[model samples]
Target: MQGENVSLHCRKKDANSSYTAKFYKNGISIGSSSSGNIMAPTVSKSDEGLYKCSIADAGESPESWLSVADLGFPQVLPNRQQFFQGEPITISCEGLNGRTGWRVMKKINGDIRICASTWETLIGSCNICNAYPSTDSGEYWCEHGEIQKSNSVNITVSGHPTVPYFKFYLVLYTGLSLLLVVILLILAGLFQHHKHQQTIRSHTKEMSLTPDDDTLYSKAIYTTLRPGETELKGHKKRAD
Candidate 1:
C-alpha cells in the first residue's frame, strides 16, 4: 500500500495444468501465464474488486479465491479542462511505479504507455494523447494496473453542432411556449372577471332607472331585468 511493491500471489502446481496462469481481482479475470505465479501491477480503489487467478486448465480447485483486498487507482491530473476535438490532451498520473506494470494507461481506448519506469517520468509530460469527438467525450480514466485510477482529468473538446443540439433547442422552446400559454390563460381569466364586474354595475344602473311600479319594493337588481341576463342569469348572479 505504501510502496507499489505489495504482492498477494499464489502458484498453480496445485492444479493439473502444465498450462499458463491468469490473475483476477474482485472477480475480474485477468492475464494468463505458463508459470504458476501471478504478479500484481499496482493495487488501488478500482482494483478493490475481488482478485483471483485461474489456470488455463482444470488442474485443481486450489486456484480459488486468492485475494479480496482493496486496490487504489493511481491519481491522474490534466493540464487543461478543455480542448479542441482531434487535438492532443495530456494527463499526469501519480503513483508509485517500477514493478513492471508501470505504464501509462487509457481505458476504453486501451492506450498503455511504457515509459513508466518512474511515476515522475510520466508526470509533467501531461500524458499527451489524442482526443476524438465521438470516443473521448466520457470520463477518461487511466491506471497502472488495476491500481487506483489516476485522479480523473477531464478533457472536454469543442465540436461542431449535431442534430441532438437542435432537438435540445426545440425542447427548450416548447417548454417556454407552454409556460407562456399558462400565463396567458391566467391573465385572460382575470380580465374576464374585471369585465364581468363592470357588466354587473351597468346592469344595476339599468335596473335603477326602471319604474318604481316595476321596482315594487326591492332596490336589488334581482327584481328587474338586465339585457343579456335572463332569470337563469339573475339567479346565478345573485348566488355570486
Candidate 2:
C-alpha cells in the first residue's frame, strides 16, 4: 500500500566490511549512508520510482522499481441517500495514505464535471455551501490526474421537504378530514332525531290540553238552546 516503510540495503561479498553507499532515485542522487542502508518511512505515491545504490570501489547496483497504491477509497461526509435543496455538503477525496491532489468528480444528468475545474474546492475536498437539487444530484467519486478513480456514491437531492415525512403528513391530513366529515354526519343525524322527538312531544301536549270533537259539539248545543225551548222543540217535531 501507499503508507509503508521501505529499507534498501547494498550487498557485498564481505558482510563484515564497512563501506559508504550512495542511494539514487530515478537517476538522481538522494543521499549517502555509511551503514550501506537507507530507510524510507511512510512511503507514498510520490515516492514510487526507480532506485539503486552505488559503492565507492564497486559499480552501481541494478535499478529496482517501487510501486505505491492507495490505502483506501474516497468518502463523502455525512453519508446519506438524500439531501434537501440549498443544503451544505462536503466530499472528501484525500486518501488514507495521506495523499492529496485527488479531485472530486460528479456525473449529473449525464454531464461530467470536476470539482477543481468547475466548482470551488480545497486540496482534496469539495465543499458546496448551497446545493441545488437540479444540479447537485447524481453520482460522485474521486479521481487522480484522470488515471485512478475511487468507488462512486449515488446522491439524491429533494426540492421539497423530506419525501417520506411529507407523504405521512398528506396521509394524516386526509385521515383527519375524513374523521371530521364522519363526526359532522353523526352530529347531523343526532340533530334530526332530536327535532323529530320534539315534534312528537308537541303533538302529545296539544292532544292532552284540548277536548275531543264529540265533546265540543255537546257543549255548543247546550250553550245555544234554553231548557223549555228544548222540550217544545221535541213536541213540535213529534206532531209534524
Candidate 3:
C-alpha cells in the first residue's frame, strides 16, 4: 500500500509551541516534517519496521513497530521446469502489485540478468524465442527487490532425436515389393513353360497313333496253280 495516506503526528503537551518532526524507521531517517506530522503516502512492506518521530528541539519519541501485512508472494508461470533445445518457452515474474519491484532473474553460465532486456516482454511475461543449450539452462525465479524471491524453476535442454527409422522402413518396404514382383514373374514363367511342355507331349502322342503312308499303302503279290498242271502267274493286288 504505497498510496494510502497514513499520517503519524507528534504532538507535544504544549499546544502553543510548534516543533519540527523527523520520521525514523529502524533508527534511520526517512522523512521530516515542520508541523510534527509524518505523512506516508503508501505504506509498503519496505516501510515495515520500527518507527519513531522526534521533536526538533525536544527528545525523540518512543519507538513503535510498524508492521505491514503480507500479500500474495511472487511467482512464475507455465509451471513446467523443463525445455528442449530450439524450443520456444515463456516465463513470467509476478508480484503482489503491478510491477512493484517484480523482476525475472535467470542464472546461467554463472551469471545473471533481468529477462526484460534479453527476453521479449509481453503482458508481464518474458518469452525466450529459441532456447539453446549454451545459455538457456539453469535456475529462474521471480524477485521482489533483494528480499522476497519465488521458488526456483530449473530448465534443461537437449538435442533433437534423429528419424532414420522412418527411412529404414521405407527402403525395406521398397525392397520387399521388388522381391515379391520378381517372385511372381518367376512363377508365371514356370507356369507358361509347363503349359508349353504339356502341349508338345500331346502332339507327340497323336503323331505316334497315326500310321506311316508307306506302311499303310503297300501292295501284296499272289499266285494261283491249276489242278494236275503247273502254271506260274503272279499279279500285284491292292488289298482293302
Task: Report the C-alpha displacement of residue 51, candidate 2, in angstroms.
Answer: 18
Badly placed stretches (over 4 Å) of model 2 are: 1-79, 84-130, 138-152, 158-177, 212-227, 231-240
Model 2 lDDT, full chain set: 0.78
Reference-based TM-score of each model: 0.33, 0.40, 0.38
Ranking by lDDT: 2, 3, 1
Question: Alpha-carbon error at 179 in model 2, in Å?
Answer: 2.6
**What number of backbone clashes does candidate 1 have, counting pairs of residues 3 or more apart or in separate chains?**
35
TM-score of 2: 0.40
Tell me the whole-model lDDT of each prediction, alpha carbons only. 0.53, 0.78, 0.69
- Sort the candidates on TM-score, descending order: 2, 3, 1
Q: Best by lDDT, which number?
A: 2
Which is the winner by lDDT between candidate 1 and candidate 2? Answer: 2
Name the candidate, 2 or 3, with the larger TM-score value.
Answer: 2
Best of the candidates, TM-score: 2
For every model shown, the clashing-pair count is 35, 0, 2
